[model samples]
Target: MKQFNTTLMAAMAMAIGLSGAPLAQATTPDNQLVIATSLAQVLSVDPQQGTEPKTQEILAGVYDRLVYSDDAANNTIKPQLAETWEIDNSGITFHLRQAAFASGNQVTARDVAFSLTRLLKLNQSASAYYKSAGYNAQNIDSLVKVIDEKTFRIELTDKVTAEDLLYRLAMGISSIVDSVEVERHVDHDDYGNAWLRTHVAGSGPYTLRRWVPNETVILETNNRFWGDAPAMKRVIMRHVPESQTARLMLERGDVDIANALTAPDVKSFVGNQAFRVEQVKIGGFYVLAMNAGRKPLDNPLVREAIAYGIDYEGITGTILGPYGRQRNVPVPEDWAGAIANPDWSFQPEKAKKLLAQAGYPDGFSLTLKTIAQPPRVDIATALQANLAQIGIRIEIKQGNGADIVSAHRARDFDLLLPQATAIMPNALGAMNDFVTNPDNRLAAKNAGNFVWRSAWDIPELNALRNQASSERDAGKRAELLTTLQEKFVAAKPAVLPMFESFFPIVLQKSLQGYHTNLWSLNRLEHVTKTK
Candidate 1:
């Protein structure tokens, strides 16, 4: 564990600009792109192990997957390593293009098979992505097969659909590693797991030049890359976690990009000529969940009462006005099969009635937990006032963000405000949270099922999610998803979702060809700081 002492942070802070560094020059250089952002939740570049936004942000440039979202639209996936692919004999087959690693070795089907197999065997957090797609240690060796140097096949079980595999593959977890290089670094059947975590051995356009964990990650363009090299020859990712410091770095010419800007700053930059800001609606929706496995909330009526008492408009329009909008369901509004504008809304009278009917003429007392962040404080305060009218005594407990996440996973709180999102824009991927209990527990391997502590299980709902994922007809799949959401809403097990919020990335006005690729790396191939 590394300790970032005050003196060290101050020194790095000076180097990156928060400590009286000079402001930017009129134009940014083409050979360099500097970014100041927070430390990644996890910095391991290993495809089989890492699972943080920062991890994907950096690794996206260093690894290639079979497919990718056609563009920043992120609504459709297109082939990358596999130029052409099709469903064949109850399995999916990919015909690889002639791709070469940075080391100039041709990529083969054997490399792809080895990469997938390594994940399954290691069973790390990244392995959960493939395990959710129905490949486990028991059958992974048989399911992933190489037909030739250029052909690869994945046989799916009845539980996993071809679409599910495609959606999962497009994510960072499916990043293809160079089998030839990784073998040289293998240690005690660890399969280079320890070395890969800190090294780059992929065929992507950028090769890591230096990574001083918790400080900086410097990448230089791979001149030997198989494709056109990134326009920005060198990218310096400096660690500047403080929002104010990152802003200072960006305001100066010290960095080309500053991410996670405060909402007020993001708004201020909107019409500014010198800087441009991008704030896209990602799937990290803000919601409240109740403990269905515990006392009073185990009753659906109580959960319903809590839901109806929340003021969605007050939270989104007031606290998060510039940053977010109200969202009714778990799936994001624009994603495929999203159930937009559902039957539920904030109703105070209905909440009072439900509480009385639950045999609690006087609303019961319970604690509401939230991260100590200012936004969560605002939203929880709003919720407290709304629920008081219905006789509910709300006690607010604020803790660290990481601690809150652990509590959610452990089912440690009575009521908690947490963000929920489908790992990607997939319908089945979103429902993996609430539908698992013990009976239909297929997607439990998927990450971030925070509300799962309630032990809520519905066999029918699980079947519906599984069925909907495999449904080829978009209309039918959408209908099934609607039914699932309606069922969950009716049951009242979750902390009712208030709104979908957003974060901002600030860049120079001349920085072109950049879009928010939410689930993968922030691609920098065509990005150039303009004059």
Candidate 2:
């Protein structure tokens, strides 16, 4: 392994505003794993509060859920904190293994019960999963109960099936926290929400050592972890927002992994012997969401015209390259309910005719908001050109992912270009956000629901979504969802899905056993480094 100069390490530490002792060594140590990626959207590490991808990745290393979805495409899961579980018509019972937290406290059924109860009590974005299953703050105590010291039970509601419920339990929202440690820090009945944002209290392979906002996050191996010990003693995640900078650092061996590389940078290391480039298909889609409540977009004709005007083939082939593929359907193709090759094509003439029929021979102008990142920015520029061809003028607005997401949540944009990922592996995860909008009122502030954010309300489609979610038979549920998608496409809904994403990552050749699935649970316990 290459070693870095002491002066360089000191200088770099000072540049990122690190205080106290200077970095002793700058080299990639055998016992340490260094990753370079953008943490711009990571606001909190709390499992219940974090909704961004980066935050979820961090929490995956620091906490363990009762169950884990190892292969989301196949809809399969494996036990994590819970050694085994049994399911009946009423509810599911989990048999937890004998484990201890980093604080040396025993993991008990009470902790499991309390963790779920706390999630409902906090009423954060993550609570949406439980809420959909009919587990609310008022009903959580009875629904989630402790059977014994090592046994826990969660009653099922008529709103969801046991199979769908398992997928939800596998998500980060169901991560089990050390209740004793969290209760100790609770203040003013906040349920440790304030403290957990910056701290971690869980029984995973790694524990939070230090976090420096948008600069860095350091994690140390948990000595008391019940699972297999991690190969690296420490994992250092540095915030390198620029793709070129991350690429340069990876080339110089300053980091072992670079996750935020652009398509061009990723291709640069394609066949290099020193690096291995991986492209994994994840469950997400790049969408162009139109505000249905807005002026001209309120008409279905306008939304259909906008959808027809997009050059899906051009954008996916050029800008996306190896990063994504064109997918018109809202659901990911790998999921069970996904439609196979729905009827959609790029026709500028068709779009113009629709616009003319909508009483606008001369297309109106509107602003399109998008994240200021590679592919997305490039995609937006392509969309701008495509719409202009049909007489519709599109003004492009760019900002960081956090700012763009905030604007979408506030319902403050005409059109939005953003990637939407399913919270769970189940098809309901995507339908819940993209198709269902329980409340369309602006005062509801339901940022979790993408349909609500777009001000889209279709009772017929919403009714089908509800039926699909509650159907106990898998085959019947798939049929219902297919019908819902067919109707959704025919209605010209506000959200237009352009392409599905494929996450590309570059890692050192010496790194082994690193795996990430559709949900982006970057588990590191099984990973090792060869010096």
The per-model lDDT (C-alpha) reads: 0.72, 0.82
Model 1 lDDT on a 0 to 1 scale: 0.72
Record all residue pairs in model 2 with backbone atoms less than 3 Å apart, i.e. clashing: none
- RMSD of every candidate to native, in Å, equals 6.9, 6.3
lDDT of 2 by residue, 1-531 (tens): 111111111112222226665444235988888999878778788887786767878888999889888753364778999999999999999999989999999999999888889988998767876776767899889898898999999999888778778888888878899999999999999999999999999999999999988799999999999989998889999999889999888877889998887888887776576677777666788888998889899999988888889888888777887678888777777777688865566899999999999988899999999877677888889999999999989899998767888899888999998777776665667766677777788887667667888999877887788788888888898788889888888888898888887788888878987878656777889888876
lDDT of 2: 0.82
Give the Cα-based TM-score of candidate 1 against the true structure: 0.82
How well is each residue in 1-531 modelled by candidate 1, as lDDT tens digits?
Answer: 011111211111123347776643533477788888755344577977776566777888888898886545555878788899998547899999887888777889998999889888877646655654567878988988999999999897766667777777877878888999999999999989989989988888888898987789888887767677788998888877566777766766667787755566555555556666666555666778787767788888888788778777777766775557787676667767676655556788888999999998888888988866546777888888888988899999987545666676667888888765455566567665555433323355433334445545556665676676567677887788889887766666555666776656777766777766656466777776566
Model 1 has a clash total of 5
TM-score of 2: 0.91
